[model samples]
Target: HMSFVAHSGTSAVGTKVDVHRSPTACNIPVVARRNHQSCSIVPALRYCIRNERSPKAPSARPAQDVTTSLAENLRALGADPQVILDHPDLRAADAELLTSSLSALSDWVPRRSLGALLERHPPLLTAPLGAWADFLASFGFQRLAIQELFLNSPDVITSSSVYRAGQVFLFLRQLGLRNEEIVGPIFRWRALLVEEADYQSAASFLASEGGVPDELLPRVASTYPGLLAAPVEGELRPRLQFLKGLGPEASRLLRGFLWEDWCGWIHGLANWSTAVAPKLVALEDLLPGGRPAAEALLREVPEALKCPPESRLVPNLRLLTGRMGIQGESLFVLLCGAPAILSLPPEQLESRWVFLLEAANGSKADLLAYPPYLLASLSKVTGPRFFYITLRGLTSRFMNRAFNGGDAVASESGRRGREVGAGFGIAGSNEYNLDLRWLCEGSDDEWLKRMALEQRAGPGGGGWSAAPLALVVGMAGEARTASHGQEGAKELAGQQQPQWQEAGLVKEELLLLRGDYDEVLSEWDSLLGWCCDKAFTERGCKRFEEQLSLFYLLIQGRM
Candidate 1:
């Protein structure tokens, strides 16, 4: 019983790698088939070539030799005989030319991958794949890498595309890097191969608008190969101009962030200047302290302008102010400390706020005192880490990473919080005593050293509870009563409740307490010694929801 095989994906756009089948698909009761194919290592394409000859016109209809081959090959591939007969071009295609094309492809691709590729892109059988293998190999692409590259972008193999791809490579080879050394990046980015990518113009832009010295142009291109394909007027110019406007350190962010992140950061609509400038200007009026304060905020945190301020940024800020009385300088400090707040959706922002208050047992004072705690991710960092701490009692393991830090910054945040709290007529020292940067910035051991000092200072109202899931997704009232009148609930509320204690709990109570988490855990279990990972995708989420439905029903006392 058991076997493994590689499967090809249908599309070239999002399907980066080939997928495979599982035993569950064959032996177990048929459920549903998976459509997304993004495996790490799967076979992709195959082809071979004979001696070069002048390209010949196709003879109408399949001759006897080609005809027998088509029927046998299609059948052997487990495809319908009618598929080839139905295609106008395939029906009329010459056997000699088809053989030559597949042969050329075989020099780079293997048989299975070639068959899979041909299934998805039948045009490859008739097109000019014969011309590309040598040219690409001259750039140092071996058989396997070439097959994967074609899978990454199959259209590059068609007729008349070679001249453009060649021009691009030659232009970039001036970077003084060996063809073999740059080959991997070329395949990954492939901007040079794109029809619209003007390598010369992008080179010129780096020299001119990009302030790249003529001496360093090659270095810049090698570092950011995709820069050759980026839309100059739309993406490149607006981002460069925006950074230059924000002062020196801010401008270096494009280089500081990872290449993919840098690209995503600069991505904007066409006519970015006309589209984005007015929005940020108008945003000044919508925020508190009006135009002057807004301009100052923009200067300090220019990345706030990454999004359309009106869409998510202002609405999220207003939600904070309207819901919890955060405005004026306090609002200013919150944004300055974590401008990424502008990018988070209003709904997710509210959920995180609730999770901090009810689940983490934090308060509005914590938000004011420690804006940095909100800087890290929620689902990836805060939510999972909070659960990990509560389940493991590793409070020392919890760390906060916020933006914009220094000793001066820490003292300034505390000073600002105190001033703002005094302005709002709230007690500042009792709750806001711990400095945000000092608490979050130091190493884990340094953070540990601060513990006795923190205890001597008294309760900062900064600890969280396993406040019911409703605190995260439902009303405060639902979180209120769900914990009481239920036996053993009080014990689990504390850190790292003992495992032996679980034996006494009623099954219904256990389900109510840990159903959602168990669902995720079960979804990932290994079967038959093979680790089967289900991605946290849409369907995976639906499965989690369905599994937890009974838990919710029991919580409502429906059964």
Candidate 2:
């Protein structure tokens, strides 16, 4: 009999085995006991015995035992044994234990929502309270919470840095906290108080009732008087005067609010001065009497001037200038100094400001011509008689109508006139007339004479002229030699002279006439190449060639 045994060492009796005898014969044994056998079983028994004696064999176990065995196998493989047991497909108890263990280690906790926390720690709520407040703000707390905190913790609100203050202001604005509501917090914290006798009792009652002080009420009402009935001038003015009496620091704070409110009111008015003139005058009265306050008010003038119609700017300018006195130079400077204002139409200009065309040195002609340009030139004229003389010369050029008309018409003239006009026109524009022949020859002659004198007088006479002349002569000689050989070669080869070379020569002559020797030499090289080309007339070429040689010798003698 051949048998398979369970690893638990249980029955080989229930084992089933296959037996093979020869090629044609086979038998299967459903074994009940270990003893019964047949001939075919004998060979199979030997085979099974050999396999069992060898290292490999199949083992059997019950289904429950098999799963337990698999679980153990998985545990040995570093897998969670309970993972298999708790698997949805596994209807097993082992996996529940594994899940429970993991849950225990994770230590999950539940959190109270923001609404519940605020309900518990009510005092914690406030605007402008740094990082914690920012975090709370994200949760959208009620406005009452913000107001309550702001009222109780005024130091917390005011002591905040600028960034924090800005954020708090933005938050309060978003919450629709009115100026009255803001004043309630301020007065509650002693940031403000009523100046009047009965007003203190009224303010105490108002504070208890969570309202703005009665005296503050009138002032606020006056500032935004359109919200109320007819202006309570006498009653409100004193309170405003009291707020203004608060020292510079308090004044600064008051001004920030007043200015903002005033600007808002002004912006809403169709005509600011007509609608808010009294308010503006009141604001002026409220401002501190000093240079600092004057500067503050003056700073606003430019923005007021910007894009205002002539009708509006004129009155504003008058009002500012009259009140600010000499310190109001800003308004005058902007009105007179800005380039854009100068471009305004004559009617607008006349309507906006008085145009005073005053001439420097009592010259009416200078005032009438290029007044703005002249004024600009005069401003740059510093401590010197020479500057005034230069200005006079410049003014004279500008005042001359003939020169201007000639300049304007020169380009439109006939060819001969164009050439003459171009020359004279350039000279006139540059404020100097140049003689081309005189410049070319006269400079060379002067230089040669100076060189001859220097050589005779020795090095003590100054050898500075020699270096510059030597450079010029060497450059000129190079040009001449280059021209001669190149022209002959081009003639021998039957090539045409280059157009650019001709242009260069003309440019050289112009530069030489202008006494620009460096530029002249640069262009002369090109001219020499053109003259050397055989395609050009020999006589013309010889003339230029001779001039170059003579010029070179003259320069060399100077050196």
Candidate 3:
């Protein structure tokens, strides 16, 4: 019979029994009855049976045996037992046995030290913390695992401090971490500071490191203005203050380096007279206001011009004149051949007059060859055109010497004497013929004739020279007025035609005049187009064209 009992608590206990029937038959084995009682009695029976241990289930093999079995199994699979064990998940006891078995298998068993592992595989130090942290935890080395992870895995540590601490807990203290290695991740963490508008963090980084990244200088310069404006007294302030102390030269150098968008920074300083005023004062002191400074400045100009190499002569001229005192006569003299200055009438003071002359009886070659400076000086005293005529005479003398191998001055004197005699109406009244022969002496007759015909046609067939003729006649009248009064000059001009007819040189003079007029008109048109295109597009009309038109009109009126 089996008995069962029940227990409530320490102080209360109860017992009960109940019997179960067993089936029996003839020739059948007798069955024992089960006695039901309190549940406490059933547990006691169970404990007794358990202690009885029917077969003493085979004693568990030693942990070493299990490890050995695993090692052998791994070896049969052609894997190193120690490697299988070290793979993080294996039991500690199994790992030990596997390690031992590997040592036995070969004399070159790899040491399982963390230092050796890290040295062999530096990338392991840079692995994520969670991966290695779980690994150490499996090995029952949680605290040491955290430490090892932090010290070895700087990339992971820098990414998260909590992860780093967890790593430290696993790895137990970093074995041989270098300061640079530790700071490397932290430094990168603070790189964001460089981009910050305050720049304090970036400046601090630079100050600590002796030099910042070369790429950051431009950013600093660009952000410096705003940063300087900020009231923060930090690393950025000192660095910026140092930069400001460098003055203009440093600013210019910085601009040269960071070529991108530097012009805006410069333009901002256009109103910054506080900074610029001192420099201007210094410049004034250096240059002063006299010819000495002007001369020195001019001396330096050639070199400056050479340095840039692309600057034009016109702007250089302007700057040169601006730097020196603008004495009207000198400026005009320097600008003699430059017709561009003529358009600047407002700039042309009364002291700066330019005269055009008709070298009526003088040589054209002599006029062109005379030194420009001499012509300029002469223009100051004599009428401009008269000076030109005198220059023409001098040029004629030179050409006469060069081409004729004789004195042109003496030749001019003889011509003048002939003209005087012809003018009196005593030399057959053939002044026109005489004048034509003298002017056409060296030139091609055919070309001269063609020019005369074109001039008679007038420029573009537009009579524009009428006004100039009136002006010229009036001037001539004025000149003769002192001798014969307006009436006599009027008569001289008016009688030109009758005189030509009486001298029987009308056709010849007209032909010669036509050719000369055509040549002059064509040349004037060409010169007008060139000057207008090159130098005076801003002017409303072409000066030479206007002058040519006027000249043609005057010739037509005379005809």
Error of 1 at 457 (Å): 26
| Tens-digit lDDT track of model 1 for 48-97 | 12323454577565578776676666566554556644566676776666
lDDT of 3 by residue, 1-559 (tens): 4334534334255544222212122111111122233322222211110111123344377766767775675555455656545544343333333343333323222233433433333333222334333322322333533554444443443343322232222111122222222221122222221223343433344334323344443344233323322333554334333334444544444443321243323222322333333322332233323332222222222212112212333333443245334333233223222222322322121112212122123222232222121223222222222222132232232112232322333344334323422322111111110122222222233323323332443444233221211111113333454577666867775644332233233456666555544454454445342332222222323545564354344333221
lDDT of 2 at 33: 24
* Global CA lDDT computed for model 3: 0.32
Candidate 3 has its poorest 10 consecutive residues by lDDT at: 44-53
Q: Rate the local accuracy (lDDT) of all candidates.
A: 0.48, 0.30, 0.32
Off by over 4 Å in 1: 1-65, 74-92, 174-189, 251-255, 258-559
Task: Report the candidate with higher lDDT, 1 versus 3.
Answer: 1
Clashes of each: 14, 4, 36
Using lDDT as the measure, the top candidate is 1
Give stretches of model 3 more than 4 Å off.
1-515, 523-559
lDDT of 2 by residue, 362-475 (tens): 222222221122222111111111122122232232223332333322222222222322222211121211111111222443333322333333444332222222222213
Per-model TM-score on C-alpha atoms: 0.42, 0.18, 0.17
The candidate, 2 or 3, that scores higher on TM-score is 2
Best model per TM-score: 1
Off by over 4 Å in 2: 1-271, 274-377, 381-396, 405-559
